[model samples]
Target: MSVLQRVVKPTTHKGKKILLKKEPQLIEGPKKTIFFKGRKTSDKIRHVLKDMYDLKKPDGVMLTKRNDITIFEDVTPVENFCRKHESSLFVMGSHSKKRPNNIVIGRTFNYALLDMIELNVEAYEGLKAFESSKILLGVKPCLVFNGPLWEESDELKHLKSIFIDFFHRESVNAVRLQGIEHSISFNAMPDGRICLRSYKIALKKSGCRIPRVELEEIGPRIDFTLRRTKLPTPELMKDACTKPKELRVTKKKNISTDNLGSTHGRIHMGKQNINSIQTRKMKGLKKTAQERKIERTAKRKALTESNELIKKKKVHDD
Candidate 1:
């Protein structure tokens, strides 16, 4: 009798939210972020980071600091952590005896490091709070850069630093830029301040409906608000020069200059030593004087024998 029963509806209500049975669509924007700190990382710094990013406690983004973690340790844990939590971006911090203050920021794709930037602690007073920008790529992406390899400006260096690899080989040109998926820009400021910006290239049509390629800033404008700290003695910085005792003095024991070691001052002298590149160079002085003398004598003997044969032939003919 009730083949078509009426669905329940609340009074004075528009409608109940419908839930899709399918898995959620992949996040197109900057979706997830994870933070991993070393065991030795300061609590104050962690607190500051939590406040700055407004991260929630027990979000699974804050990872437990494992012991035996070093600055030069393998990044497999980071890759695994991100993969486990489905995080796209991660900030790794470590305060080591090797590198006093260093932090590495990186992004991942399918558990592989897409890009990373390491900031060395030049000077740090105290960090109370910091600000970070949320960047996102448009639907499409393309890469763009300028300058040659050797004489590339500092700004170009900073721009190229964030990108793991853009160009296929060494050289990049307009011909090799086909099917490029990301847009990279290396131009910085006029005062030599490095401010790299990445863009996503998209096509937008005007009134005529003709598609025009456009670029929009995506993510990663890593600008650290420098916090002033009290550095150690300025006297520590001094001009390095070779002292009198630093010069290699010839000793009279049995060793000569040549027997001392490699000419390139290499401690480990072996066949595979890279300092032996000079041996591959072109040799200037070829044949020795004694070798030239012997060659001349041999040539003269051959010529004299030929002359004697010719004289005999003339005599026979006569």
Candidate 2:
């Protein structure tokens, strides 16, 4: 009898969960420092920070503690943090004695800020999933505040409508809000680091209404009217070419020879006229006979010449 050994292989059961461990990579904070400066002291800054934190609430706000702010350090990190958390709304609050209370509301993508101003909820929901899902991509909204309070004006209503239409179209996602000290002066900051200062708010509103008049119809209408006018036809052209000019006739009276009682002059004229008529008739008859005689002579000469040439040739041959 041979001894047989049986071995069991471990098998994974269906629906069993497997755990995988991922190693964490340490990332260093920005080497540069960021400082938030305003005309007011840091006490006002702290107050503004608190207000912003309260407004943002549950999402929790990320603030740079450094005294100096840089493009690579402060702005970049805030943008990155917003993207990592998939934050839909961003509020920027700055306190300065020159411009006491100011807030900026905006939206962002993972890569670039949209050029237009947008509301918070609308901006986030409107972002394209494929673009926003990328790593390390940051975007911000264009700032909308300048001059006066944006919410108070008719221009605000128009601008809001335009923004809503644009957002529904998913055309843009970033904006910035700025604060200015003067009532007439304001600043608008967009994501591209561009700023418009002391811009007139009324001017922006004046352009809001869509132009009602249509320019496209003008060209076709003019063309149609022009086509209706009568063009010159061939008949009209022929008539113009063949029309006769007017003739002006002037009548003149001459002294009569009969009134002078000259019988000799009259008799002389009658004889001359009779003689001229007879001469013309005789010349016509003479010309016809001469022409016939010339034709007969030419025929006779041609026959005699041909006979002589023939005889000469025969004699030479002999």
Model 1 Cα lDDT, one tens digit per residue, 98-174: 65445565556555554455544342222222232322322223445443631354323432533323122223234
TM-score of 1: 0.33
Clash count list over all predictions: 6, 18
Cα TM-score per model = 0.33, 0.23
Q: Which TM-score value belongs to model 2?
A: 0.23
Best by lDDT: 1
Q: Model-by-model lDDT, in order? A: 0.47, 0.33
Question: In model 1, which regions exceed 4 Å deviation?
Answer: 1-27, 55-60, 64-67, 71-73, 122-318
Model 2 worst lDDT window (10 residues): 218-227
The weakest ten consecutive residues by lDDT in model 1 span 225-234
The candidate scoring highest on TM-score is: 1
